[model samples]
Target: MATVELRFSAQPEHVRTARLVAAAVARRAGVDEAVLDEVRLAVGEACSRAVGLHRSHGIDAPVHVVLTEEEKLFSIEVGDEVPGSGGGASAVPGVRASGADDGDDGAEDEMGLAVISGLVDDVEVTSGESGGVIRMSWPTTPATVLP
Candidate 1:
């Protein structure tokens, strides 16, 4: 397996950089064009959410995006520094709180977690020693053998 990691300030503009890097890595891993699009969007959403959460909590740490290429799958993890209080709510203008009973909150309307869940094969959110993380993975296309 190979891994590519990028770390940048938790700023909104950096989200685009994360998406581009994810697409480049997916392409390098022989991901299909259709799935490439999904990877791009999913990475963007994950990065945006992390950045938003960090900013909301007034955290000045950088966000980390890591892409891993394996034999049969490609995985991406976006993480942000843990807030001082151990938890922080998103205050980004368009992002909605992640919860089932939060009422619409426009989460479905916008490219939030809901959209990421649909675009990627697997999506997971968790908090760890470093911070909160959004993990996404997709199956890779089988390598074609030349006759």
Candidate 2:
């Protein structure tokens, strides 16, 4: 089994750490260089969304990243603190609302979750319920990247 774990702040600067961690994992998994870059980009976009949506109710929460390489696919799970610290009312992160699909200058310049969905074979978003996790995965098969 091949897996990598990383922890970083929810701040923007820390997103780079997440990206680096992802790239490292992909490389270690023997993923194609081109496919590796795509994974890194998708990881950054997803983690950034998670950071933006984390609840800021006086609780300092670090983003958690887990990359697991299965025989057929690579899975990435990014998790954040839930509302009320995984208790009381459920709070979902709002990063999807800030997607790059909006008709704005910033949106036009950056690739958002929509692009992420396009690049990967599978993408999933799950709000922390009693502290749940959001995960994304893609097939490692070379044909997945073919034109």
Candidate 3:
């Protein structure tokens, strides 16, 4: 598998860059042309969610975006440094971030994930003491970018 990793401060403005990079990489990875818009929207939702979580919780660590190109799949993972509930409550769909106390933001966060869910067919969300990641994957067209 080939991978591209990006780190950015928890800022709203940075989200657009992440979305653009994700789309370019996904295009090179052979994600269907028609689905490029979905990829961009999904990445934006994921990154925006991460940024909000970081800022609300006073976490200084950067947001993480990992794009991986595999034999037949392209997957993007967006992660946040916000701590999770020791029990992983955030793992539940539409639930609040594990340890998040931003009441209204929690609702917005859930809505963001919902949007991402609608855009990407394959998605995995996980959280723990370390952080949370939203992993979205799509099928490729057998055209992988060369080094």
lDDT values for all models: 0.74, 0.65, 0.81
Question: Which of 1 and 3 is the better model by lDDT?
Answer: 3
Better of 1 and 3 by TM-score: 3
| lDDT-sorted candidate list, best first | 3, 1, 2
Pairs clashing in candidate 1?
Answer: none
Ten residues in a row with the worst lDDT in model 3?
85-94
The RMSD of every model to the true structure, in order and in angstroms, is: 5.5, 7.1, 4.6
Worst 10 residues of 2 by lDDT: 86-95
> Which rank order by TM-score, best down to worst?
3, 1, 2
Q: Return the lDDT, model 2, position 92.
A: 27
Best by TM-score: 3
Deviating ranges (above 4 Å) for candidate 3: 85-106, 144-147
lDDT at 124 for candidate 2?
70
Residue by residue across 1-147, what tens digits does model 2's lDDT show?
A: 438888787787888888988888777665777788888888887777556555333336777889998876788987766542221122323222333356353332124556677787777755544443557776665435437
